[model samples]
Target chain A: MTDATDFAGSSREKWTGFSANQYFICLKGILVREWLRYLSQKERFVSSLVRPLLWLFIFAAGFRQVLGVSIIPPYETYVLYEVYITPGLCGMILLFSGMQSSLSMVYDREMGNMRILLVSPFPRWYLLVSKLLAGVGVSLLQVYAFLAIAWFWDVRAPVAGYFLILPALFFAGLMLGALGMLLSSLVKQLENFAGIMNFVIFPMYFASSALYPLWRVQESSPLLYKICLLNPFTYAVELIRFAFYARIEWTSLVVVLAVTLALLGAAILAYNPARGLTVRKQDMGGSQ
Target chain B: MKLQSRSPETPRTDERAAVAALELASISYNYGQRKALDDVSFSIEPARFTVLLGLNGAGKTTLFSLVSHLFSPRTGRIRVFGQDIDRNSGQALRRLGIVFQARTLDLDLTVRQNLLYHAALHGIGTRVARQRIDELLHAIDLTDRIEEKVRGLSGGQVRRVEIIRALLHRPSLLLLDEATVGLDIKSRATILKDIRALVERDGISVLWATHLIDEVGQADQVLVLDKGKLVADGPVATILSSTGTETINQAFSKLTGITDMNVRGGRP
Candidate 1:
């Protein structure tokens, strides 16, 4: 025991201090881990792109002849369906990426690594935010990769719009990522995630203005248009769509921002140790 | 039954200095209608190895969760080194380290990466984190395995890495919740020896939670819980003597009023 004290005392002096810099270190570690995981799983990159490209090339090409899209603000002339849906596909990339990150969060919780993150002295909000930021970072990379592919496919945004869209992409990614975080807190098991993709991912994508313009939906059915207007995913897609044209979609921006903040607040509450959705039956011994 | 007196070295006086490394005062937790811990109260001294002995569903994990702030007690207060866990959780948690009952390492990550990430969370700089990691790995005789991914490591090896991850920030109090649950006898013994050595040599207070009676030593302090209630708490010899039993197994059976072999098996 004396030896233990002696060793600790001497050893303690070599590395013993805490500072704000550690926050960045933690954030860096999280981002690096995400990057490493992304790098290792080349299939994820391919899959993420494949979904959007399928929509752009296959669905867009097929719909081009069938659908008549009026010249949207960003487009000076009547555009091909592929050109119109490119930004929507960008939104899709973010949506799936966000959900994928949350899937990992659920996995982390089940596997006990989430406990490691929660136990850190930092505020839970900070940890959750870091996770969101890392997810957003990854999702943004995927978005740009998709965009670069689109560029080669002759669906080019203005050169400046490509750079200008970064902030829009970030905010959209954050909102979707935050929503995913909230869902992860509510979801108790991995088996339930497939249900989320079905109920959340598919509905949000199809019901929103991602595929067809809201007016077109209104012309076909006013009720579906009303639902599309209410869907936050609509705003996310609109934000990206407008960004690609170097145009400001204030309504979309405001809606996405509001949804992001609300979902973020709800997520923090859901993850709260005292009264959050994370309170589990296993944690409390039989209580759900 | 006459309760034995406190050890002479036990600091029970000077209220401020004797606040204990960890303390739970009237702590109670519930899962909706079901009570997980009922008015549990205890305190552990610094530099001592206190074994929290309990059977399955005895609220051991619940208690650990509360202490780690994963779940806050609906009633009562928990303090770490006199810092209130609820009111001052950041400070309290800063002095604490924990290895949960479940496996926590990211299997894809290298040993060094896992530890370094934890170090960064505690706000330890990279340079200092690297130095501490090196020393701890050396201490654990895992210096050569630093670059190896956690998935390649054996269960016992991963547990060792988790322990090292917990200690990287030099937390004053270390908690292990059923850390040896799945390990072989040799691995369990090695871990137990290493942790006990930490207390004896480094003066780091330890709260080792498990149901295994064999893990409790005569010199060690024991806090026994049964069915979410604190049944007995004292030195091992004192608990045995007070119960009028020859061994801890018999004493635990006597205290809990359960004679079933399966209940006393401590297999899980």
Candidate 2:
């Protein structure tokens, strides 16, 4: 004879015993949990789709007529500016998308669920990486959706080029995600987030190869051109630009990797429980 | 919930105190130059309800935070069933449950959904998790309102939900830190009765941190705290008898040396 209930109970307990690796597991859980949440918000998908579409339709439409084309590698000759800038705009979208996800971390803190999450028995670093990966996954999906729309237009790249962008996008997303995490770990106040946007966002974009080629900037001003060449976003946009030709830029990939690893490591260090953006207030009494 | 002579060490597995449910030995925590908790030590025994009694700024929450392994302690040890919380926190926390002073339930989730999500975090199987959710709904008197959104619930209802959520994994060492907020008299009594029943059925140990003495007299033991230090700890009867006070209020005031009557009247 079998005690079905008791046996089932033991097995259930055995399963939860695996929660010792809680940080990674909980991070995955939050990913799926928030993914479902993101799905339910019809407005979020609409906005993600619309943001890139507007830039592709309006900004590219106007800029295609003005900017002179340059022979970016893998391009046999000078190509239209629209095709050149599509990946750059996508990079911009992802950069902000990563930061948007970081803002949610601040929101979660105000909600108190963050306390439940951060107090879990898992390693905090793994937990943070899991969250970063989830945000990057969402950003990549939006990028693909934007690319699918681009194919409907005359801006299509080679069929094989689509497959090559995966790793490029991953590292790119990782780099931006690291930046977002660093900002979130440092910026504890919601009111000061706008300060990050004004200071970090536009400067990074205007200084990168997203809007124009590095050579074009050098032709105009040497100092601005040097800043563009040094910017990591330049490497990210360059990765996407090269991948469009169904070829990977090995140098750009290395640069993005180095930057992503260093920034993510820095974010982890800043997020140490002993200091940094840890909760300053403890609830001695119940909810106010 | 049926178990006998539970080992405190392997509480989640054997339903015994496997070791002591929780142990804090010579524990001290510092923030910059200030000490938040100074040499605080206590052990929670199986089936014994212990109340951590203290006032505001008394370092009660700091002690709870250290025990939960939210951050590493500057000095000393925190253990569950003799397992160091830092090194073996996964196994140690598995044996215990905590309801912090803040409301932790996700407002977007229903009562059942909230429990289900927490169970998933703990890696409880879906089938067993569902059954436990239903059991908790009944236990918390929320069976009729299981699907209602948590944001819609009153303060008292949310408190009950937190307790039910904590108990879903059937933790051997349950911690309630000022969990009485927003709860009315009847609701409080109901919650107290349910937890007492759980303690009797499984001999589960509990450490409830609270400022009020009335709601906690049922505790088997009481640890009196003043500032960041342990002032007294013993059986409830013994503590009250030695303090020479009729109630927890008079006793608390007599010990703390601050005889402000207004603070005492707020106790129900």
Candidate 3:
């Protein structure tokens, strides 16, 4: 209710203040809010690292005697199956973590909070992409933790392999992240999502090079080798496999990029408000 | 329908039509062949509080669903501020906010976190959104309970949270679908007062969808949907006069032809 002069100088000051304040807020949003969510979920952090450690410990011990990993291009000397599968195992960790985060979407929807999210004014794509990015960030942390464990086990990659893995991990994470979004939007109920783990994930993982190389699988059965090569999970494991050896595999990169794009497209189609799975009734209020 | 033009000097050109913030024309929806909203047509005028009254099986929720774009009608179109909703859903929806009959909130997060998540999704910047969150907490009387998880909130408090959440975007058109289902009179009055204040102070258009006759009055406009059709539309007193009834309770029964509607019994 003050006069004209009081408003004039304040309006000038407010304009510059808004511009400065907005950039600072956006920075805080991505780093503090998104990154801090992972730090808060202490159990998720622990479990992501634990599942891979179990595989490296007991499963690798049992399989090391039976499985004979022949000469791989990256390995000059004959390495044990234990050393051969570490990269694939790391990829398995990222793959499972991505799908695990995606599977949680149905639970969030059933609990009713997803509705509050969709109704917001932001373009729906940004909201989802940011959430996916946060999931990727979590996957990256778990991947590093797994690598640290491998180093402790006396099975180590080259010093430069870690730097090379950054981009490889990024592509693999995007591909898996996209798959998670696709599964989340398609699955209606939280209970129904168990199929994603058992049907979608396990087959994709087993069919890939995570356990054995494509050449070894081909030696056993050409049909199994073909199945493994066709799997998006194969590219995920192969990409990580090559990355661990500090080598580049162009074919794996192409396959991972293409699958990532395709999955993201499918997820967006399934989530589009018009006829997508999101239109279904979301049961949100309390039972009481 | 009366249109209110804004002053020439202001850049806000879209502020037109004080009489009906949202208008629907011959809108119809179906589940394959079975009609959900049967050739329904209605207009919700601006500033005047309106209540959509109906029975349980009537198309009250269906009508609200179509209006809110949860499910669009297969036939006809919906308009908000003279612009067709489908053609400009982003702009139209950005200008409108809704709270469903069922509460839609994240139970895992704290009330403050939940609101902040919504603000980020709504594209509200961090600083302004933070300030808005504080203001909304004060307005909804949840300032003290901001840090508490939503899983622990009382039913009435949860309901209040949902209402305030809907109003976060400062929508020109606010849709409340069965907002006061099981609340006591005190909670109900607070929500009603908040909505009333929105209309008086912010010029926000509200469509209060409820089956209860006590919620709507003689002065307010009322639309009765019986069996997926727009049964009657006008001021409560005017519409009631056609049935030769004084109170909305008697008028609702007379107009919709419900003779055996007992207070405690199930809806037929």
Q: Which candidate's TM-score is highest? A: 1
Q: Write the per-residue lDDT of candidate 2 for residues A1-288, one digit (tens) a residue.
A: 012112211212333434343343456566775675566567777787787788778888888878887786768887777788888877987888777877766666656676666665446677678778888888898889889888898887888878888788888999998999888777766677888788888889889988887788999999999998889998998898788777888889999999999999988877665552455442223211
lDDT of 1 by residue, A195-248 (tens): 999999999999998899888999999999999999999999888888877888
Which sequence of candidate numbers ranks them by TM-score, best first?
1, 2, 3
Winner of 1 and 3 under lDDT: 1
Residue pairs with backbone atoms closer than 3 Å in model 1 (clashes): A1-B200, A1-B201, A4-B201, A4-B202, A5-B201, A5-B202
Give all TM-scores, in the order shown. Answer: 0.92, 0.87, 0.86
Residues B1-268, candidate 1: write the lDDT tens digits. 0111112233323433555889899998887788889999999997889999888778898899889998788899998878798777777787788998888888888898888778767666677778777877887788899999899999988998888888876777899998888799998988888888777666678999987778887237999998789989999888989999988888888888777646544422
**Cα lDDT, model 2, residue B132:** 74
Tell me how candidate 2 scores on lDDT: 0.73
When summed lDDT is taken over every stretch of 10 residues in candidate 1 chain A, the lowest stretch is A1-10
Off by over 4 Å in 1: A1-18, A283-288, B1-18, B261-268
RMSD of 1: 5.7
Estimate every model's Cα lDDT from 0 to 1.
0.82, 0.73, 0.70
lDDT score, candidate 1, position A86? 83
